[model samples]
Target: MQDKSKEAAILRSWHKNVEPWTRAVRESEIRSRVAVSDAAIVNAIIAQSPKHVLDLGCGEGWLVRALADLGVTAEGVDAVAGLIDRAQQRGGTFSVMSYEEFAAGAWQQAVDCVVCNFSLLGHQLVEDVLAAIATLINEKGRCVIQTLHPAYSGEPYCDGWREGSWQGFSEDFSDPAPWYFRTLATWLAMFKGCGLQLEELIEPLNAESGSPASIIFVLSGSSRK
Candidate 1:
């Protein structure tokens, strides 16, 4: 029940934050994103040299636009209609679809890559989405995920729920959504459970602090095992 409400709160927060969120991405307001995670996730996906990529939970579709510019056929889907509208207006193919819809196999085409860039925010729902992604990609395909490292969670390192906030951002952002946190071991176990094998774990660093700004997990279908 708690998980369900937190999940719903996430959607509500995004719905209310479309404008500020879009502006932040467009203006590169987030320091961590501007400094490292954005390039890290993009480079990780490009390394696979995918032909068609799906940007799951893609907010305003900056990643889609970026990949499209690099000649990849990229499509983005978001639960928020406003974000999808903004994404379409800005360029790139986008649709309004929730993670539940996606996990239920809403997207029929098999792609070479699927990226969830700091977008996997649910509990069991995220597990469902990961399983869907594993089956949605070709055998040789990969799923690139960029998210805050477990170490950054700052203590009592175990799997649980955590409240999210927009402390460092501008005043416009509000209704901060709560997010589920997973420790490193739990993360790996979840991937394995979803039939995804970890290909690489990249820790993109912040130049100033020299600590990892975020972690990138490069995973591939585990059928080869």
Candidate 2:
């Protein structure tokens, strides 16, 4: 078992430097693509009447801001202090803390919905995180998770393959942080084992490249009663 504290520190350092560059890239072309995909997922959950939502691993609290715009009470948590600071500056209620720490505290059983948008991957303790998320959801509550498609996992981080072409590995620039690249089957099985039933799975087409590189999952927990 990796020490959660050590993992958090490493991730924080990685993001502290990378986030500025990422934010710029996001603003250029990535933001619009992410907005389209996230908007779809957020809209679907809003239709279901979400009241209290938790945005886990929320980088800069984009989803939290969006949910607040839609009149939902939302809070975001992330391990990167710089990102959390940026999120706060954007008017998001965010805390700089690891999910493991938060889940072990008073907020464990309090949220109505939990959403992890493209941030839960690369963690060594994914199962533990899923279990923690399950505990956070109220009965019949929902959970949403998104990750890079396994087909895209091994690709070079910088080589944009015209959207659909599967480019083989060129350079592994992924953060040295450990990541689990699971197939769709493995993703489903892990969630099922944690007692959440799959509600929907969406493979998003990259707007610029027109390739499928992201997978979104909507899940519901078993009734607590």
Candidate 3:
């Protein structure tokens, strides 16, 4: 098990250390090249026709803004207050909250769908967040998770829980957070632990690089044991 206090401190550091990073993401267009699976995610959510959606760990609430175009009402929650504040400045309904608090029943609003995006980081935090989501959704709700491809992680490839400045996306930002790299099996198992069944999985390929840019999992609540 990972310490919530430690993860909370790390999250604050990430938000405190990266003001410009959040700004860039907040101002970025929906179709930015760095947006690995924004289109796919939005499409998937639209296809589901969810009335109310939840954006867990939604940094700056870009997805919340985009989802509005499809007429799907959404709210966002993040551990970083600065990020939440910035997201609110953009006319988004965001709350400054953490996974630990959420799992402990902080938020009472159950949603029709939940999207984790690429913000689900850390080993224990990931499982904790998934477990929280399980109790925060309606009976037929879905979970949309987009994360770095398992095939593109590891030694010499920047895998596991390591701390460093933001280097993969660009050299413009500076922030260090412990990112837990999990295998495909581990990710699927975590979803199962949350009482979610994998309905679909998509590997979004980068058009320019000709390789998978990220992995997206579409899941729904299940009673199967």
Clashing pairs in 2: 163-209
Candidate 1 root-mean-square deviation in Å: 0.9
Clashing pairs in 3: none
Which candidate tops lDDT? 1
CA displacement after TM-score superposition, residue 223 of candidate 1 (Å): 1.2
lDDT of all predictions, in order shown?
0.92, 0.68, 0.76
Model 2 gets an lDDT of 0.68
Tell me the deviation in Å of residue 112 in model 2.
2.0
Better of 1 and 2 by TM-score: 1
Count of backbone clashes, every candidate in sequence: 0, 1, 0
Model 1, residue 213: C-alpha shift (Å): 0.5
Model 2 agreement with the true structure over 1-225: per-residue lDDT tens digits: 444554554575457455553364346435534546666668656865889998888777777888899899999888777778878877868888766676565355467788887676444466777877887787768888877776666654432222222122123223334344566677788888887788877777767777665777888885543
Ranking by lDDT: 1, 3, 2
Best by TM-score: 1
How far off is residue 169 in model 2, in Å?
17
